[model samples]
Target chain A: MSNFDVIAMALKNLFKRKLRTFLTILGVIIGTASIVVMISLGLALNKNFDSQISQISDITLIHVVGVDQISSQSQGSKNKIKMDDSAVYNFKQIENVESVSPIINLSYAIKAISGKYSATLNLVGIDAQFLETLGYELESGRFLNDDDKLNIVCGGQVPYSFAKNTKRRFYFYDPNQQEKAPDIDVMKDRITISVDMDYGNIDTTGEKSTTSTAKAHPVKFVGVLKYDDFSYSPSDYNCYMTIEQVKKLKAEKQKFDKSSANNNSGFYSDNNSDGYNEIDIKCKDINSVKDIAEKVKDMGYNAYYAGEYLESMRSTAANMQALLGAIGAVSLFVAAIGIANTMVMSVYERTREIGIMKVIGASIYDIKKLFLVESSTIGFLGGIIGALFSLLISYLLNTTNISFFNNDSYIYMSSAAQKPLVSLVPLWLCIAAVVFSGLVGLLSGYFPARRATKLSALTAIKSE
Target chain B: MKNIIELSAIKKIYKMGSEKIVALNNINLNFEQNKIYCILGTSGSGKSTLLNLIAGLEKPSAGQILFKNMHIENFNEEQLAEFRKKYIGFVFQSYNLFPTMTALENVSLPLVFSRVPKKIRIKRAREMLKNVGLENRINHKPSQMSGGQQQRVSIARAFVNNPQVIFADEPTGNLDTKTTFEMMDLITGIARKNNQTLIIVTHDLEISDYADTIIHIRDGVVDEIKNKE
Candidate 1:
């Protein structure tokens, strides 16, 4: 018979027993929905984890620390590696390296005085041009520019350090009173940075001594940083200045220290003769971070990047998805068994009908095709309904904040500023669900269809 | 007249546990084209078994059964299905109409198996039903019609494919006397009009009167052969 005729007949037979067909198809629908929802939830978790990690630090940025002592394989001897301007230039030449900045840490004892309020703060020097590429988002004013060498930007919480006078101490561990913005505006007020030669000194009696002499340097506040919940780096509590400006301040401090009776050696002297203590390198893409980091380590420097953590996070997400998929697969396997059972029952009930068909010149292939078409139609119909149901569940999960589990148990809990979209169903997944269910139906009907074809016309016709 | 089917030394055996029962024993017969023939026999006389062997529904154990000189016993199941589709039609005592299908659909089944297009097959089925006086009942299902009408629909189905031969096994066995005579007249008239070979198996002697040739079977073998013309 024509394929169209066979399909029509199969449909007619299925419709003959509507309730049974519907029940079988319902099993498939539940199977498909379970799988799709499970996979979609896994994808949503992965996306949330990625966004949280991205907010903390740039995955492509690698921190390079100079090795104090390294074993030189070529010379068969030990040597020291310095992270200097030359190292920055070498890193810039590395493939996929976008930008490199040498970090010069200044240990000058300095305090910022605005009107009567003053505070002691840490300081770090960085390249003014590469500040934007380093992913530092400014809060108020523009970032450091090459032309503004003397300008400085205060951290978001730096303003909270100023009190009524210089003797007023600030404690970071105090949690009773939240720090408020100081009355003195660093952006508008005339701020002077004073360096103390005898800062942190003690007498023979072990009593704290005030600075005997100090020099003040006038400076401009160009910008302030935005507060980051996850950032505990110096940028959160210290100040940033151009490398040239810090170099000049260091030279002045050295001159003043040499003229004093108390000739205390500087802490920055070890790498001061050649280069800075560290360098930060930015890669063009996250995928290239590992390769560039390895190259920097091969040059006898210590490299640390977030790529390793991100890699582990990705693998964990994939494993969770696979586990969820297996759970879904078990449901679909049960649905397939339902289909096979239904088809076998149909064949048993239609034995006489099948015999009549055989007597009327219907081929064994036609008999098999008819049963296969019936079962597959059930599968395809179930898949469509199941996909639609999954989409509805996904939409509800994304829009609603109904939390069934402990909030802290979720990986995306840190990024709780917005409600998490916990389920995501992509287009490819919908299509695959439909096609896979259909294949399951075909496989389930195989044995039943074969049995229908092998039925004896003589015995079957005689059967009631 | 040319022989449409020939059975030479054909045997059919059935095994019930360790006991052996011979259904047909060394039977030799020839059915001519464009002629009405009947195998008259009582129950368990092998008349139906002989008809089944001739239709390629069963295989012979010791001899050859040929349709137009082709050994039908050697044909595989698939080949037999093809043979039945192209050259044979069957009418059963139970009518065997698919209750879910309409009268027109029931009649058009053989044409469907032959791969005839829908429009043409429906048109031919309508014409054949009209010839059997079932034109008005084309849309009625088998359950909706009487036994006589159901048998008429079955007859229309048998002749709708325009096969070379038609087999009827107790076609009127479930009908009353008047309906039986009506069914016999309709079947024989159609077979004559189409010039097709007709083979009917019945236990009733009155039903054998309509056939041009009669082969009386007894004890798994042919007892006698009689011709009217």
Candidate 2:
């Protein structure tokens, strides 16, 4: 018989017993909906975790520290690895490495003065070309460029670090009253940089040494960086300048210090000539971070990347998804059994009808196909309804502040303040649910359809 | 007259526990084309078994049954179903109409299985129901119709496909005397009008009188064959 006739007959048979068909389909609906909702919940949790982690650090950025520093701190090794311009050039040659920035933390003691507001500043010098690639968000103005002369970029908390010059106390933690942010705008203000000449000086003889005067240089404030509560780098409350400008200032300071000393004993340390203190490497892709970090470590540098932590987090999320999926599978397996039972009962009830059909020229294949179509129709219908119901459940879970997912006691403390969507069902998942349910129905109906085909026409016709 | 179906040395056996019961014993028969034949027997005489074996609904233990020079006894289930679709039709004693369908739909079922288009099958079914005097009740289901009317619908179904041979197993067994005569007349008239072979199995001798030839079956064997014309 034609496929159309088989389907028509199957539909007629199903509609003949409406309540039984509905009940069977309901089993499949519950199965599909539970599976979809459970998996979607796992996906949503993983997404929220990733966003929270991204707020703290750049997952793709790798910090390259001196191997000697790490070995010395950890194992009391005297060996030192120098981080200089050549180190930056070598790191940039690594495969999958996108960009590299050489950083110098200056040892010179300096202070920023804006009217009466003065504060000791932690200064860092870096290549101006890598300012954009460092992943720092600017609050205002622009970062330092190669052409900039004596221009500085300050961190968002730099103004708050200022204090009264006399008492030398931080404005952020004044004991007598609540501290306020200094009235100093880094983007529009002219900041005076005072170089303390007395810094790094110690008298060997038992004589009273006079403190030298501070040399003040007026520098244009360029930009302010965004504040990060959990920054992996020491960018907060620091002033950033180009390496060339910082080198010039250090050279001039060294020359003046040599002139004041009777002997040329006040020279800066020889190790400071190489300029950079550390190197930062940006990878082309987050997945390539681990390989690049390993290559850097092979070169005897200490490499730190967030890819390891991100990988562990992803593995945990995947395990959670699998557990949820397995739980859902159990319900679907039960629904499959229900479908098989319903199909077997249908075959039993339609024995006489099957006999009549056979005697009236219906082939065994046609009879079997009819039963298979009937059962699969139940599955297909149930899957459609189940997917739609899952969408509804997802929306309700996302929109409603359910106690279990949204409570303060939940593990995602960072995302707890803002309501995170607890459930998400994507498009591919809906399609997969329908197709999977239909396949399950087909598998469940196989034995029953076979039994239908094996029925004896002579005996079946005689059945009352 | 040319023979349409020939049966020789046909035997059917049923095993109940360890005992073997011979349902048909060495039955030899030849049914001619365009003729009405009746097999008359009492209950337990194996007339229905003979009919079933001839229809290829049951396989004989030993036989050489041929239809149009092809071996019917050796045909598989699928081949038998194909053969039945092309050459045979049946009217059961219980008027086994699908209760869910109308008379017209019941008549069109064989054609539907034969993969005929819906419009042509329905058109032919309506014509055949009209011929069976069920024109007004074409849309009426079997449960909604009287016993005789349901039987008429069953006869309409058998004739709708216009097969080469028609088998009626106790066609008038459940009808009143007047309705029985009407049913027999309607069935014989259709067969004769179309020159189709007809076989009837009945226990009533009165029903056998309507056939052109009568075979009396006794104790699983043919006792006598009488030709009226």
Candidate 3:
């Protein structure tokens, strides 16, 4: 028989039994919704995680550290050791090595004196080139220029604390955004101090030593940094300075030590000509930072990053998303069961109708198609409803201030000022949810259609 | 006149718990075109069984049943459906009208299955409904109509296909005497007007008057044939 005839009859039959038909369709709707929602949730989680990971550090970054000479000696000479400046230079030559910077720890307190305000703040010195080696967005003023002499910049908290004691305001436009005014200014206004020695004991004896106040230079308040809640604190913080200033301080301390006949505070080298205690080497690009770090480690010094401090902070969100997706998929499986049940009932209720169609010259193919169409339609409707529901949920979650980010467990390096948290659904993900739900309907409907076609006409017609 | 339905030594056997009971015993029968015939029997006498066998709804246990020289007994289920659609019309005792459909739609079903155009199918179905005097009740579903009206709609469905043979299995069985005669007259009148072979299986002796020939069956065997001059 013609396809229209069977479809018309089946539809009419279904309409006659409205409750049964609706119930069957409901099963498919639930199934489709479950599948779509499950997958959508999973995808949303994955997306959140990926963005979080990218925020902390690009996945392609490779960390390189200097092979510890002290450890190598203790472990015996079996391990080859060739880590040196040449290795750092070689890493820079690598194809994908975008940028590299060497990190060193030196804690020193700074004593600043303006007309009325004066305070001591501990600071780690990072070179101007080191800023370029990492993904750092300047808030207000420009980044440290190559020609900057004795220039200084500080993290988000530093300016907040420093400006409290000083008359000059720190202003820097947040580089993470656009159209906002400059808020941080670290140029010619904030003063930073350096000690003659790196955490060395100050001599109590001798000519009016460190106990006596020394002259403090006025540093510019060029810019302010946007808060990264995942990283560094403002109270005791790192500061950017020219390598020449650190060398000058070391030389002055050595001269004072020699004159006093005391060897206690004269710990480090005297000049930039004698090589720096820390060197912040930068590569041409950020992509090669990890490779260059590896090379730097091979040279015998520790390579560090501001990015590594925020690693867990970024990755935790991604992990949460993955977990969410996995949880959502379980609901879809239940939906599939609903669809199956509906289809089975439909087959049962329409046995006589199917038999009649067969008697009226309906082909087996036609019978199979009719059932499949009905099932597919049910699934498709379910998917649409599910998608709408999911969209609403997503919208609510986004609009609500439900904080899924920023916690005490997040490892905040000395760099972060505020926690990072946001959720966004991509277009492709929405489309995929729709298409996947449709596919679920088709697959779930297939078995019932086959079963309906295989039913014997004699028996089906005889069914009461 | 050519015989439209022919049965040669057709046997129908029923197996009841390993015991084979012969329902129709080597019955050989021929039905001529343009005539009304009734198979008269009590329940389980195999008269309805013979009708089913002739309609290709059931296959014989032995021997061949032929329709216009084609061996219908040898036809498979699907082939039999095609054969029925093309040449045979059925009128069941309970007037098996699709309950959801109106009288016109019910009558149009066979033609619809025939792949006839919608306009043509509807027109022919309306005409057939008119012939059965159900033109006014064309839009009424089976459940909304009386037994006589439903039976008339059934007769229209059978005739709408313009089949060569019409098989009625106790068309008046479920109707009252008044409606029974009305149904029989409408069915026989339509079949005769179309010059089609009408086969009726019934227990009512009064209904036999509408037939030109009657085969009285007893105990799954044909006892006698009566011609009403």
Per-candidate DockQ vs. reference: 0.64, 0.69, 0.45
Question: What CAPRI grade goes to candidate 3?
Answer: acceptable
Q: Which residue runs of candidate 1 sit more than 4 Å off their true CA positions?
A: A65-77, A80-98, A104-124, A135-141, A145-150, A154-189, A192-218, A223-239, A244-278, A284-287, A298-302, A402-417
| DockQ (0 to 1) for model 1 | 0.64
lDDT of 3 by residue, B86-142 (tens): 988888776777777789988888887778888999999999988888779989989
Error of 3 at A257 (Å): 12
Better of 2 and 3 by TM-score: 2
Give the winner by lDDT. 1
Off by over 4 Å in 3: A1-14, A57-87, A93-95, A105-108, A111-130, A133-148, A153-158, A164-185, A188-192, A196-238, A243-330, A360-363, A403-463, B226-229
Lowest-lDDT window of 10 residues in candidate 2 chain A? A169-178
**Candidate 1's residue-wise lDDT over B114-223, tens digit each?**
89999999999999999999889999999999999999999999899998999999999999999999999999999999999999999999999999999999989999
Instruction: Estimate the TM-score of every prediction.
Output: 0.83, 0.82, 0.78
What TM-score does the predicted chain A of each candidate obtain versus native chain A? 0.76, 0.72, 0.68
Which TM-score values does chain B get in all models? 0.99, 0.99, 0.98
Give, for candidate 3 chain A, the lowest lDDT window spanning 10 residues.
A194-203
The best-first sequence of candidates by DockQ reads 2, 1, 3
A448, model 2: CA deviation in Å?
A: 1.1
> Mind giving the per-residue lDDT tens digits that candidate 3 earns over A65-145?
445667557656775444334544665666665554433323333444332333334333445565645556665575566
Q: What TM-score would you report for chain A in candidate 3?
A: 0.68
TM-score of 1: 0.83
User: Which parts of model 2 are misplaced by more than 4 Å?
Assistant: A46-60, A65-98, A102-125, A135-139, A146-150, A155-184, A190-220, A225-239, A242-278, A284-288, A299-301, A402-419
